[model samples]
Target: MLNRNNLYFIRRKVTNHIMLSLTFLSVVLTVLPLLLIFYYTVTKGLTSLNLDFFIAMPKPVGEAGGGMANAIVGTLILIGIGGAIGLPVGIMSGTYLAEFGNNKFGNVVRFLADVLSGIPSIVVGVVAYTIVVLPMHHFSAFAGGVSLAILMIPTITRTTEEMIRLVPHSYREAGLALGIPKWKTSLVIILRSAWKGIATGVLLAFARAAGETAPLLFTALGNRFWSTKIFQPIASLTVYIYDYAKSPFTEWNDQAWTASLILIALISLISLLFKFLTRSKY
Candidate 1:
């Protein structure tokens, strides 16, 4: 009996070591691709990254020494528009679902949100085209913004609901005992407590929207020159990268790499900003 027990203990120790090794290997495999991509992008993109790239407009065909100023501005504008339309609605919807949505209607809304999240982005773009572009008889930044907003909504709503739900029931009860109205408690206390997670969700949504190309293809309809009007075609970094990468010219290809680098940098900066904003004041 003593010998048998010793053998079993040895076997369990070996099995645990094997599992640990496998998990470590899996982590390395997962991170390797991301590291390689970042290295490759930086190496390739650095050749064309410069002040002019951020300040000047795209040069005409076969020309050299141009930038993506308009595209950068347009990308920011699109995100701003999407955030303006999507944030409040998503937060409010999530609050309702978490606070009062325990029945059939809540389940239906939750199901719809899940389905919406899974839908292809290109399909959303097409829907926006039909709803916004066709009526206006042309593609515009507004249509692009609408498509991005739709994409953002489900992620934000679901994230907000989960984050709010994580708040302790005691906190709610305490607020009620103190005579605070339910609406005020939900808005001021619950949301404030969950704001960090909600902000993360918003950042994720913004990053996804910023990188989208297919949706904007059918909506914003990339422009060559600078244009900021909501009803007009707009330039965006993803679209510019798409167009530039496909071109036969070497300069454009270099610019595409640089543009990709800028997009990544922009997203990173926004992430840092969100982190800073959400840092605990205590």
Candidate 2:
């Protein structure tokens, strides 16, 4: 057998080596792509970045000056509507899964949720087109919002359930011991404790929904004019970027790059907010 001193030295050396390797790998895997994306976007998109891009409406194809204000507004409206439609339903479903669900029914619901999460965004757009756009006789922002809501729901439900599950069982026991109703305990005590996690999930869902282009393609129909009406077809930032990027015009391409940069910034901000919200205070 090795001497105690030698054994200790060997173990320490092995552990330090392993930790160094893991740290290096983690840095490479996570930081490299983010740095590259940021560098590329800032370099290319900064040229077209201006206040007018955020304030003015899109002009005709050959027009000298224009902006994506309409698309920006429409994106916000669609995301807001989607959040309104999905948030409560997802939270309720998650509450059921974490608190009340069991056995076969819960399993089936979970499977369906996972399946929905995996479905392609384009397929969702197709379904929305058939059900809402076709039946209504026109594409509208509402239909696009509904499609995004469908995509958001599964993500929120899964995250909420996981967050609720992470709450300590001791809390539940204490609530029960106090003779609190089970529903009240679950909603009030458990959910409150898990609020940060739920908020993180909601923000993540919003980020994902905001970036989706396929669902809005057929439903919103990509307008160039400012549209405040929920019942009217509208343009969104994602669709605008996608369409403009493919155009031959240099100006349109520049706008696309700028819009993409803005979208990336928004997603990064949301992610940072989630991290801030979830960071331990102590």
Candidate 3:
């Protein structure tokens, strides 16, 4: 039998070991599901991934061996337009909130942005449908882009505001002390300092917009063939995944898995890029 002092020391050692084991177990549990998802996606999607899947147009129903080249291209186009619209507007709003947000109107603007961010994306799609699709009397890529940009605006706004606020007020004062205009100081000193963080926000918004399907359904309306005109219908990866996954055909089903893999990869890449950019010494 050990002395009481030795017993106490053993108890502390055992407790520490147990706590460490629990921490490692928790990590494993968290990572297990992600590992399973990646394994399944790779196993199922690899067979369907081919050169033709990137180069060829989507085939009609009852056909075999087709690709989502149009959807790929359209997805890029919609995101491009959405980012263009959201980036400047979001940056401006964020700058306003950060610099002039002590007032009641600024509070109202921030509240509105929070409300907009929380609104369901499907609801934004409906609003865009009413404003753009109905007015144009057609389902067009422009409407889809508008819907995505609406979804992106709030996130970008909040992120930009947060990043700009992190810039030391001393930097602002220094520029102003040099007799620079407030606007010029904001643009040159504050915004430039926070550009990397803003870029992360923009990339995150782009990834989110790329994955949306509901907004595009009633807006872009899913083109089967290649279409470059923003005024015309367009294909999108999310819509294609939705349409193909529910089909009875085995090939389309496989393609859906591949599309899912692509989407997952794209999102992960964006997140990784954000992590890298934030870690960099700008």
Candidate 4:
């Protein structure tokens, strides 16, 4: 026997309560784990972080006052090389998928990209080791870069394709109506329009490659010394963390924590940069 006003008020209250509950649940599910990881990393890892940790080389097990310079350099070189190999190929393939490859060949390529994306990182590492390391008779930063490039290609290609597709058809149509060549329109107008999304994808791909350990495990083989040569084995942060954390020495473990913190910070900065870049574009 509720009045109409009472009934309406009750419905609104219930809806608001449901939305509040959902919002709380979502926040807990998403933010809680991230908070916990940040807390743990800062607590365990920050203690080992210092100027020496960044500037000097790794010391013997019991000694301190060393840095992760070699590892940091190796990581940069590997990621740079990987991006160099993967970026152009991925962008071109993605452009084709979205622009001109609208046939059976395109479908097959898309399917293969999907499959490649799903393949495990360790498997990719194994493939790289077999094909690159074994054949070349050495583990090197170049091999690790090639392996990471393989992993990055699929992600970049997929993201590029989707981002390009999101560009309004009207842009392409307008370019065509202006009598611009089709290739020029697709490359210039459509690509510029979706550049933000593509840039975001590229940043994400770099972040993804930055943390990869499995591929580098076999391909790079974790050198302790600074290596300027691409053909020589190089130590990366991921492999350094893995190797140090598992060692019997407590100092190595601390160094591992410091390196892990550096990695988390780097990835977080990249993600924030991507967010800012995309937001600015809009």
lDDT (CA) for every model shown? 0.93, 0.91, 0.90, 0.90
- The most accurate candidate by TM-score is 1
- After superposition of all CA atoms, the RMSD between model 2 and the true structure is 3.4
lDDT tens readout by residue for model 4, 176-274:
999999999988888888888888778878988999999899799888898868899998999999988999988888888889999998888878887
lDDT, candidate 3, 214-258, per-residue tens: 999979989998998999999988999999999999999999989
Q: Which pairs of residues collide in candidate 3?
A: none
Per residue, candidate 1 scores C-alpha lDDT tens digits across 210-266 of 889989999998899999999999999999999989989999998999999999999
Clashes of each: 0, 0, 0, 1
| RMSD of candidates 1 onward, in order | 1.8, 3.4, 2.4, 2.4
Q: Please identify model 2 stretches exceeding 4 Å from their true place.
A: 1-26, 273-282
Against the hidden reference, what TM-scores do the models get? 0.95, 0.88, 0.90, 0.91
Find the candidate with the highest lDDT and give its number. 1
The TM-score between candidate 2 and the true structure equals 0.88
Reference-based lDDT, residue 127, model 3: 95
lDDT of 4 at 44: 90
TM-score, prediction 4: 0.91
Model 2 Cα displacement at 150 (Å)? 0.9
